[model samples]
Target: MNDTTPDSLIPYDEIVQEALRAVVGRVLGQVEDAGGVLPGAHHFYITFKTGAPGVSVPPELRARFPDEMTIVLQNKFWDLAVREEDFTVSLSFNQMPSKLVIPFSAITAFVDPAVDFGLQFQAVEEDEDDLASAENDSANGASERDVASRITSSEDGSNVVSVDFGKKK
Candidate 1:
């Protein structure tokens, strides 16, 4: 008559997150296979961890974002290269051309506006110490852009599909 849910050793959230990231990889791979052609007005908005390990971007952009940032893969992006661990693409920001290399582990959200299909993830949360450090850094030097992008988009009425299996109290 044990009715309580036992805590399993398996990390279900990490496993599910890994699988979902593979979906993003597969979709991007399909686009790569199609010679980087986004089919029939389909465009993607990808949000990722700017400070995640293995992520590479210009210093200025990092200073501007300082945390997470979203990029649109639509009419203007170029040099879409997908690799096993990461993807690199060229995009323009404020008319300045730049290249971004992002690891799959860094991605937190992906959306295809044409189909209104989206996948949102429970991205790795920062540790308390890290959060305190970040807060200190922001207070000392972070800019408006950095503060702006840090805003979460849970209730924006966008077509994002997010799944949260949090326990109820």
Candidate 2:
């Protein structure tokens, strides 16, 4: 019995999760305010679940990244659209242009390597009742983990704000 950790009646985990997700929203909102342009060398690497509901992607992309996919938003990206619950962007892959629409709920990680800042989040399912269920993802030919893994920080690095809801099943 560890007295150090006390249980609470409040759903602290859910509260904190929502708050942290807001951080991503706010940052994107800021970028949208700044004429849809990334400031200076600041760029982003956003990773989200491909099959999560509300996620819209090209057939080839969904085929390439059947489970989780990471996109780079630095120099070549265009049509950066941010909404209340989701964002859409256009990027080129293998010299082929593609558009991706991903809800924040599907995002597992967001990283700005230029600033050495990152955020790791717990991956949730589109269905409430399927939260703990794992799909036999063909993307990587394996079942993806529900937790986001931190990427190795850059040379000019800092700490990543990662959240763990302790809901792993």
1-169, model 1: which lDDT tens digit per residue? 9666676688887788888888899888888888889999998767777889999999988988777777778778888888888899888877789999999998877767576567877666554433311121222233434323333333656455555556544
Writing each residue's lDDT as its tens digit, candidate 2 over 72-143 gives 677777787788889988877778888888898888777676667887667766445333222323222222
lDDT of 1 at 6: 74
Once model 1 is optimally superposed onto the true structure by TM-score, how far is the C-alpha of residue 10 displaced, in angstroms?
A: 1.6
Q: What's model 2's lDDT at 65?
A: 70
**Each prediction's TM-score versus the true structure:** 0.76, 0.75
Worst lDDT window (10 residues) for model 1? 131-140
Best by TM-score: 1
lDDT of 1: 0.71
